[model samples]
Target: MGWLVGVVAVVALLGFYLTFTAKRVDRLHARAASAGRALDAQLVRRAATSAVLAEEHGEPDLYAAARGALDARVEDREAAENDLTRLLRKQELDSSEASDVAVIAASRRVALARQVHTDFVRDALAVRSRPLVRALRMTRRHGAPAYFDIDDPTLPSVTQVTSRATRD
Candidate 1:
């Protein structure tokens, strides 16, 4: 009777462990999805703000090109965004309201949001790739998660230093 009770206890403990792991994997996947959406929103904000700045302060050609790219379809969005970046790099625009503070803040938000999304994706991937999860087909229901990649400018070193100093 003692041996039988021990066996039953071990089985119950194993079952609980498996259930907990499965729930954790599901939570991670959900977190990754949420982060991805946030990143997408930030990206859109960056592009729209850039377009506005380009129109207000950039040359006419730059404004036209940027406006077109901002309105581009989803299939061509990546390339259009890359082109917008290149155009901005080629010109020195006047500091209108659009470019003075708004664009700078938008760019910074995009960089931070991208980093957050990437971290969440890594967490989900780590959980989904675990040996037990893989063997048990635990993540098969949700399919695979993907990482978002985009080219955006980093915040200036001066801005970074000032922010750190203020925090301290």
Candidate 2:
């Protein structure tokens, strides 16, 4: 009788642990998804700001790249964003201009958002990769999280302009 009670207690504890782990996995996945959406929004904002700057500065190449990023399909998005970043890097943006300032601000936001998205995805992937979680298929319902690999969206102009302003 004692042995039977011990077995039941062990099984109950196992069940509780599995339930807790599964719930944790769910929460992490949700957070990752939210972060992805935020990152997408920031990327879009950056592209839009770049497009405006390109228009005002009469830069056809920059405008095209920005538009391409805004219109890119999911599979092509990273490349499109990279192209935009490259073009932005080549331009000598005047921080005094309102449009230029907006572009710089947007770029900063993109960098921050990307970092947050990367962290959340890393955490979710880590939890999902646990041996017991995999064996029990805790993440079966959610697709594996993927990192959005893009060029460093941080613009050199941003740092330079910020330092210049601070010194003034």
Candidate 3:
């Protein structure tokens, strides 16, 4: 009788633990998805700001890169964004111009959003890779989170431009 009771208790505890782990995985996946959406929004804002700057400066290459990033399909997005960043880095913009200042600010926001999205995805992947999670298929319903690999969107000149703008 005692052995039977012990067996039942053990099973009950295991069930509770599995339930807790599954819920945690669900929450992490949800957070990762939310972060991805925020990152996308930041990227769009940065591209739009870049497009405006490109038009104002009469830069065709910059304008094309920015537009490509904004219109890119999912598979082509990273490349387009990388091209836009490369073009942005090559340009010298007057810090005093409102459009230029907006571009710098947008780039900074993209950097921050990308970092946040990366962290969430990492966490979700870690939890989803646990032995118990895989064995029980806890993440079977959730799609695996993918990291967005792109060039660092923040320009090195941002600090200099920002400081100069602030001093003016």
Q: Write the per-residue lDDT of candidate 3 for residues 18-75, one digit (tens) a residue.
A: 8899999999999999999999999999999999999899999999999999999999
Which residue pairs of candidate 2 clash?
none
List the candidate 3 regions with Cα displacement exceeding 4 Å.
1-5, 157-168
**Regions of candidate 2 where Cα sits further than 4 Å from its true position:** 1-5, 158-168
Answer with 2 or 3, whichever has the higher lDDT: 2
Taken over the whole model, the C-alpha lDDT of each candidate is: 0.73, 0.92, 0.91
lDDT (Cα, tens digit) per residue for candidate 2, span 18-87: 9999999999999999999999999999999999999999999999999999999999999999999999
State the weakest 10-residue window (summed lDDT) of model 1.
Answer: 153-162
The most accurate candidate by lDDT is: 2
Ranking 2 against 3 by TM-score, winner: 2
Which candidate ranks first by TM-score, i.e. highest? 2
Summarize candidate 1's per-residue lDDT along 1-168 as a digit string, tens digits: 999999999999999999999999888889888888897687677677777776676467656656766687877766776676666656553344447466667767877888888898998899888899999988987757777666764433222234666888
- For each of the candidates, give the backbone clash count: 0, 0, 0
Error of 1 at 35 (Å): 0.7
lDDT of 3 at 42: 92
What is candidate 2's CA lDDT for residue 30?
Answer: 95
Q: Give each prediction's root-mean-square deviation over alpha carbons.
A: 6.6, 3.8, 3.9
Over all chains combined, what TM-score does candidate 3 have?
0.88
What is the TM-score (0 to 1) of candidate 1?
0.77
